[model samples]
Target: MPYVEVSLPVRAERSEIYPILKEMEKYPEFMADLVSVEVVERKENSTITKWVSNVDGRIIKWTEVDLFDDANMHISYKQIDGDLKKFEGEWILTPVADGTEIKLTVDFEFGIPMIAGLLNPILKKKVRDNSLNMLTAIKERMENRA
Candidate 1:
């Protein structure tokens, strides 16, 4: 598995930030590489979203069920089906002084036979870059929000 984690301090209150974070369906609009995201199903505290992302100009898609914990300011997700063998992660939010500390963690594996190890390094970098890009996009949007 390839893991990528990022922690960023955003100058937005946790209450203000959590709402934007809950709106996962809007990711494709702001996150550059996210081409499309649709909420297929939603329950009381969980949602199933299907996403298509362009990575290195190649289209990769996946479906994940996000479990939202409103009280704790956390979002955890695991792949139900995708272009990969295994994908799971979480987004954790903690209150800071006049802001929120957001952390994103992702674990992914291509699940391809034989060449998996060979592609690990490349995939690791991609995951790290993508995570950073996502965080930057969110920070920009949140800070600029009216």
Candidate 2:
């Protein structure tokens, strides 16, 4: 398994940013790497979503369950069915003196143990870059709105 975490400070309050984060389907509008995000099911505090994203020109698809903690401005998600063996992570929003700090994490497994050693490093970098891109996109969207 490989884990990647990226964070960005947005010039907005946590409360102002939480709602935008909940709108997963709108991500594709600002995120170039994301092809689409569809909400398959919506629950009281969670949502099941299907995602299609391009990573270095390779298309990756997944379905995930997202658990929302509105009070804490946090969201945790795990793949129910996807291209990867395991994919899970969380988004955390913390208010600071200047603005809000948004953190995104990703944990994944390529599933092929034999070649894990050879591929993990490259995969990690790609994942990290993707995560950073996501955070940057969110930050831009939030800041520009204000």
Candidate 3:
């Protein structure tokens, strides 16, 4: 398994950031690498979302369940089905003096045990870069809006 985490400060309140984060389906509008995000199902505090993302010209698709913890300023998601063997992560926001500190953590695995040793390092970097890209995208959007 490979794990990666990235964090950045956003010029906005947790209150403002939480809603935009809750609206997962609007990601593509601000994140160019995201192809689309559709709400497949909804529950009181969770949702099943279908996602299509482009990474280095490769398309990756997945359906994930997202649980929103508005009171805690957090949201976590795990893939139910996807191109990857495993994918899960969480977004956490904490109030900071100037704004909010947002963190994105991703855990993933390619599931190829035979090549795990050889690929884990490379894959880990890729996942980390992707995670950073996601945080960067969100920060850009929220900061510009503020």
- Specify the poorest-scoring 10-residue window by lDDT in model 1: 93-102
Sort by lDDT, best first.
2, 1, 3
The model with the greatest TM-score is 2
lDDT of 2 by residue, 1-146 (tens): 89999899998999988998999999999999999999999998999999999998999999999999987889999999989999999999988888999999999999999999999999999999999999998888887873
> lDDT of all predictions, in order shown?
0.90, 0.93, 0.90
TM-score of 2: 0.97
Candidate 3 vs. true structure, TM-score: 0.94
Each prediction's TM-score versus the true structure? 0.95, 0.97, 0.94
lDDT of 3 by residue, 46-75 (tens): 999999998788898999999998779799
- Residue-level lDDT of model 1, residues 22-137, one tens digit each, is 89989888999999989999999999999899999989899999999998878999999999999999998888886888899999888986998899889889988998899888
True-vs-predicted CA distance for residue 61, candidate 2, Å: 0.6
Model 3: lDDT equals 0.90
The TM-score that candidate 1 achieves is: 0.95
For candidate 3, what's the RMSD? Answer: 1.3
Which runs of model 2 end up more than 4 angstroms from their true locations?
A: none
Off by over 4 Å in 3: none
